[model samples]
Target: MKILHTADWHLGQLFHEYDRTFEHQAFLNWLIETINSEEIEVLLVSGDVFDISNPSATSIKMLYTFLREATAQNSNLQIVITAGNHDSASRLEAPKPLLESSNIHIIGTIEKNSDGSINYEKLTIPLRNKLGEITIWCLAIPFLRMGDYPSVANASNPYSEGVTALYREAFEFAKTRMSDNQTIIAMGHMHTHHAEISDMDKTERLIMGGVECISATAFDSEMKYVALGHIHKAQRIGGKEHIRYSGSPLPMSFSERNYKHQVVIFELENEITSLKTLEIPVTIPLLRIPLKAEPLENVLVELQQLHDKNDFEQAPYLEIQVLLEEPEPALRYKIEEVLKYKNVRLARIQPYYPNKKESTSEFNQQELLHELQPVDVFTKSYQAKYSAEVPEHLMELFQQTLIDVNQTEA
Candidate 1:
């Protein structure tokens, strides 16, 4: 059986203040072609199908349109998608009855039985071969929230212990329904302790509680392959080749402009699996000015030289980093005027100034009001309110909230 894994689509996402309908549509189109060409029998999307729990009508349309087109192009293909933290569980699974007939399975939340017990049967999905015989059983687990995992009394790390227990139980349950020759695989949307994060961007920040990162040992070693999500960089978990994150297909932020956005494809035969990655073609480019923070005078020259590559219909997104001796109030206006006729969208203007004598905690009210960023403000407020440095998960939540607000306001 051949399986393709991808995640973090963030459909209907806006880059800077600009709509990304074009880029997303282009990707969906390319994905359909890849499905047809690769002869893939199954597709697994780990999570974060939408940028927010409540998505725009246009964004919702794009997803359904892609699904209809994809299934039409490949009749034998089966797609399994799970909801991430950004998705409203019920909303993503609302169309389940209508979609299952077409070989599309959407697992949004953990379903419980009338007796208040976790329904393991619903969590386990059977992967069938071309001959309509079940050859693999996939434990399709979504982004687990509070109360979703089993309660372990007096556990030091409740969230981590709960998650580990849930998976252990799920895996054990699958063993009963599986044949001796059938393979067992799993899917998850989480942050493992051994994962590496590209700290360059705030777009992929994922945190649920004070302690959300779990041990990679959450999954039993007996599982053949584990497809993961929630991190944007494609990488293997620890040293395990079969455990991996396929990453986002588009750059989530300017810091990730150079990330080789891709999807993972692997073929499983006779309990052995082989992995390969296919890079997604960039529909629109993301460019940085001067490659480093520089004086405005130098950055201007680079922008002027980029006029030759300008395309009004499909202009590249640009992020300018300016090193300043003093505040340049007209910096934005100047760049706007320079790019008036050029084919580029000014996304961000990052300014770096010389270090001040006062530390971040020493900033006055006036300075805090005008000089600090939303993140800085969030840090100060969280410290004042909680009387401690902000937890990484809280900061991640604040960052994710800020991104959502910015996208909405834009």
Candidate 2:
């Protein structure tokens, strides 16, 4: 069986607040072409199909078109989609039945049991080949909703067993339903254990109590192959060979520039036989330049270094860091003009005035005020020149403070 693992599409995502509709359309086109060429048997989208929970009408329309096209074009494909934290479960699940007719499965929200026990809400979707001999069971674990675990979060022993109990609700259900005869392909939209991570990956550090820092053992079940997501860097977790994160298709942040976006193609016999990754080129270019030095000669030398490095171009987005002791107004203008010619977006140009003496603890009130708003040096002068007169009652408080000081001395 051939399986394609991809995730974090983040459709309708804006890059630095700039609309990425055209870029996203290009990505989808690439995806469709690749899918057709690859002849993939199963397409698994782990999560984060949309950029936001409440996607715009245009985004929704684009998604529907893509789904329709995927269903219509791929006759042998069994497409399975799961809801991420960014998706609305109801919205994504709305067309599940209709899509099922087209061999597409939508696993959004957990299913409930008649006995009031939580069941595999979106788990164990199976596809059978002719002769009923070959069966592939897709175990989909969508974003786990905390509310689905009544026995855990709201249990009598909430301190230690809360999270463990909640996870057991799903694991226990999956264990009971799993069949040894069928080939199980598990997919989840969560951070897993021992996943190789790079500093350049755009995923922010999960805080002490964040969701992404979940225990990897939660997924240790009787599944042959595991496809995971959430971390934006494609990697294998737990050294299990089959477990993987396809990562985002594009660089979502400047920090992610070094990370190459790719999709995983897994060839399965019993376990993941072999894995091949196809690198997807970035949609838009990013440029970063570090300029350090001071004075005309020193700054000029830094500029020379940038020019010699072939970075003096205007086609890509730019991040230039200017490090100087004290750049003059004229020098700043010069740098801005040169950067403008290259069509560079100045990320930041830090001014370092090393000669400026630090203020002492015994500094006067006026000096302190000046320190507060150093750039607006004339604020104190303006206030003193044209400020409103102080009220008598407020002025008397100042006088009382002086009197209290004098009494203390006496």
Candidate 3:
């Protein structure tokens, strides 16, 4: 059996303010061609099919259109997709009945029995070859929320323990249904303690914290392969080659500009013989001009040189960083003037200033508390934690949040 593994599509994503529709479409087209040419029998999409829980209409259309077209082009192909943290479980699984007929299996939410127990049978999916013989079994486990798993009475860590118990129960049931030579593969959408994260990933950290992460030992040792999602960097878990994250197909942030996005392919002859990576071609490049903080004059010179290059259609998305001791009120305008008629699109402009001097004398708590306003208290608390004053942009955001809260109360 030949299988392709990929995850974190994040369709409908906006890079800064730029729409990524064309880039995502190009990737989907390339994937279709790769599937047909490679003669892959199975495709596993781990999670994060959409950028947000409420996706745009265009994103939904693109996803289904690609799936339908891919399955039609390859008659023997089987696809298994599970819901990620970014997906709305109920919404993603709404068309389960219709998609199943086309050999596409989606596991979004856990089903419950009348007695309020989980219906474990629904989690086990059998993958059969063209001749209608079962070759492998898949434990399709989607992203687990707080109340989704079984209750663990008197457990120190309820969430983590519940997750482990869920996998154990599902794997034990699958063991009974397996034949002598059949393989058992596991699918999951949560973070494992053994996985590595990319330097650029900000969202995954918010989704997968220390309290939410499960250990790699939660998976059964007998399983042939464990396909994981959530992490944007391609990596193996606990140095085990069979357990892996295929990563995102596109760079999610400017920090990931140097990352080589790819998908993993597994060829299982008897016990998973070969593994290979096929790099996804870059449809549009992301560039950080100067690559580091530089003076305003230096940045202007680089921008002028870039304009002279005259690379129009394929010009990369640009992020500019300016180093200054104080604020340059017209910095963006200056950069835009320099980039006039340049091919590149300005995605972001970041200004870095030296840290303010700290007070040498420490005041008593009583004196400080008496003089502080509500906003002052908040700023002091933030400075104590981060060791810096809140940026002007963030302070503006905080004021807006206060306004929103006041309106809600009113």
What number of clashing residue pairs does each candidate have, in the order they appear?
0, 3, 0
Q: 1-410, model 1: which lDDT tens digit per residue?
A: 99999998999788997899899989989888999899989999999999999999999999999999888988888899999988899999999989867889999999888987788888899998899999888999999998888899999888889999999999999999988679888999988876766763233465654388878888998898899988888889978888899998888788678788999999986565678999999988998887889999998877887775445557889999988765566999998878887778889998875443334453444574777798888787655443456767767988899999999999
Q: Rank the candidates by lDDT, best first.
A: 1, 3, 2
What TM-score does each of the candidates earn?
Answer: 0.86, 0.71, 0.87
lDDT (tens digit, per residue) of candidate 3 on 1-410: 89999989999999897889988999999999999989999999998999999999999999999998999999889999999989999999988989767779999999999999888888888888878788889898898998899889998778889999999999998989988778889888877785666665645544535777788888988888988888888888988899998989998888778777999998874588779989999988998888888999999998888754375545678999888766566898999999887878899898775554453223325445767665677677656544476779868978898889889999
On TM-score, the stronger of 1 and 3 is 3
Q: How much lDDT does candidate 3 score?
A: 0.85
Ten contiguous residues with the weakest lDDT in model 2: 306-315
Could you tell me the lDDT of residue 77 within candidate 3? 91
Against the unseen true structure, what C-alpha lDDT does each candidate score?
Answer: 0.85, 0.65, 0.85
**Clashing residue pairs for model 1:** none
Off by over 4 Å in 2: 130-134, 150-181, 194-212, 291-315, 324-410
Model 1 RMSD, rounded to 1 decimal = 9.0
lDDT of 3 at 366: 47
Most accurate candidate by TM-score: 3
Model 1 ranges off by over 4 Å: 200-204, 208-210, 308-310, 356-410
TM-score of 2: 0.71
